[model samples]
Target: MEEYIVSLNDLKKSYGSKSVLDGVSLHVKKGEIIGYIGPNGAGKSTTIKIMLGIESNYQGEVKLFGQDIAEDSIEYKRKIGYVPEIADLYDNLTGFEYLTFIGELYGLTPQLADYKAKNLMELFGIGEVYHSRIASYSKGMRQKLLIISSLLHNPELLFFDEPINGLDANSVMIFKEIMTQLAAQGKTIFYSSHIMDVVEKISSRIILLNNGKIAADGTIEELKQINQEGSSLEQIFNELTGFNEHQAIGAKFVSIVEEM
Candidate 1:
């Protein structure tokens, strides 16, 4: 069995009495792609932020590459590739320039960084936009740029938050393919998304968070066994997180609005 590349124990976080994460624990094996799913306020992103060292106020035991993140944050962060929900690239910079900047931030040599940036742009089918200023790029192009920036350093672990939010269908497929390929080469990936079908397709395991705590953790088949046969990913997700209740009410409200 592969060793765990990331682990959390009794993790807790709160935003001034509004508890965001409560006693969440998880383990991600090396080379495994783990999908983190939850509702809007379910603490998925909070946990990810804590792990990334973006939120120091958080209280927990988070280890990256078996090193305590709270203690060795800078060192731990160097081993991670992160793609945030929002793209914050410099609009005036070309795609290639933006990636080179990110690479430099990680202390890479200019020539090596540029070379890696060029290769990543070509690999992700974004080479055509390499010279175009980010301000002129479309949403999909920006997302592609963000992805390339996060990956330029070849980090051992990748963290993506809603990675497919603005991607086209083809781009989404490419992203999924790249993720699996990376994992096959002994990289760990942790991503958070509301899209159940994609998670079911790509993740080696899924961790469902509900109301600031972990609801379930297992493979698709293991989660499926929690309910009867033939249960879909969406069905299992709603059943475990109790999200179906709100969804049903929303559906009825939409129906009533349509009648008017």
Candidate 2:
């Protein structure tokens, strides 16, 4: 039997007749970097929150590492790492202090976690801020700390939603390479972002969710076939989501601004 790192069967969610996910089914294998893309309110983050056990009251089965998560499989989380779009940090804690604390929660020794955190911070070019309080760190520095914290445990599967929000160009390049290397080593990665170019380059497969369901799911080349008239993923996305008013919207926004 083929092994799947993540499997969702007939997943559905709603809020007072407003459907967020409608019969979504998927199976992700090891060593695959999946780009989960969609417009705002498309349930992209909702699906991830479900997988991470942060949300509930949905219909369907969610299995991780071949164990049903709905059934007392909480221990499976140890093998998973997640970097959310916006996460709360302990502003009072220093960078190293917070990272080591998080590491301990994941069952790592304080010494080992600090050592790893130190090296990661140094590599990201924020070594000097290692001992600085998180409240004093800049936005980009905090983002780098979150990225490092997620990887400190060396998880087998990872979920990254807008992981490079505040990273600079160089840091973004390094982060992209890191994802490629991790996937090459048989780690699964589910990356959700609005940045189509990064998704196009790093993802082994792309899954597009529009409104509340999987409108498109396939490799980059295969998805291109869906929109044969289009030239890039962005174009294909616009077509799949029934959107092509970029120029019109831009012109209108400029005119509105000039009216003032």
Candidate 3:
């Protein structure tokens, strides 16, 4: 039997009368790279927040490594690394200082934390600016620091939301390679992104969410077969999510702009 590292059972979240996630359920096995794609406002971030134990008011059960997350939040969190969509960091601190702080939080010794932080920064080509304040770094530089911090502890599972937002082409390539290697080492990854091509190429399986529900879940080839012959992941996504009218919407906006 395959061991599932993460499981969500009939998960539901709401704010008053507004339903953000409605009976969402899924299971991820070890070494699986799941591409979690959805249109904006489709509850992707909400679901992630619930899984990471950041939102405790939701209804349903989330288990990590066969243990209920609510039973022990600290232990659950210790087994996972998360890279949120937003790069929220202390701008007053230098890159090295920030990473060292994160390392300490994860229970690493000061000497080991400093060594790993410096080595990782060197790998990402940011060692030269390690002493510079985060406020002085570019967006891409900050993102690199964030990625390093998330991976410094070598968690068993990773959750990445729009991780390629500020990365250049070369850095994006490097990031993809790193993800592939991590999966090969039996690390489970939940990757959420708007870049269909990258997700289609990298994900072992894809899950499409819409209107607080899972619209489709399958391999890329399976989803394409369900949509149409020779359909790309983008086309399959559009068909499932009712976003095929975007081109028409864009044209209408252009015409309206011209009149203005």
By TM-score, the best candidate is 2
> Using alpha carbons, what is the TM-score of model 2?
0.98
Model 1 per-residue lDDT tens digits across residues 1-260: 54579989889999997999989988888898998898899998888888887787877688889888867968877788999997577999998788888899898998999898888888778788888899998888888888888888889999999888888888899999999999999999998888889999999999999999898888999888877642777888878765557768999999999994
List residue ranges in candidate 3 displaced over 4 A: none
- Candidate 2 lDDT tens digits, 1-260: 99799999999999888999999999999999999999999999999999999898999999999998888557988998999999999999999899999899999999999999999999999999999999999999989999999899999999999999999999999999999999999999999999999999999999999988999999999998877976788999999999989999999999999995
The lDDT of each candidate is: 0.86, 0.94, 0.91
lDDT tens digits by residue: candidate 3, 1-260 = 76589889999999899998999999989999999999999999999888788887988899899988889788778778899999679999998899999999999988888999999999888899899999999999988998999998999999999998889999999999999999999999999999999999889999999999999999998997877743788888888887668889999999999994
lDDT of 2: 0.94
Q: After superposition, how far is residue 134 of candidate 3 from its true place, in Å?
A: 0.4
TM-score of each: 0.93, 0.98, 0.96
Candidate whose lDDT is highest = 2
Query: How far is 104's C-alpha from truth in model 2 (Å)?
Result: 0.6
How many residue pairs clash in each candidate at the backbone level?
A: 0, 0, 0
Backbone clash total for model 3 is 0
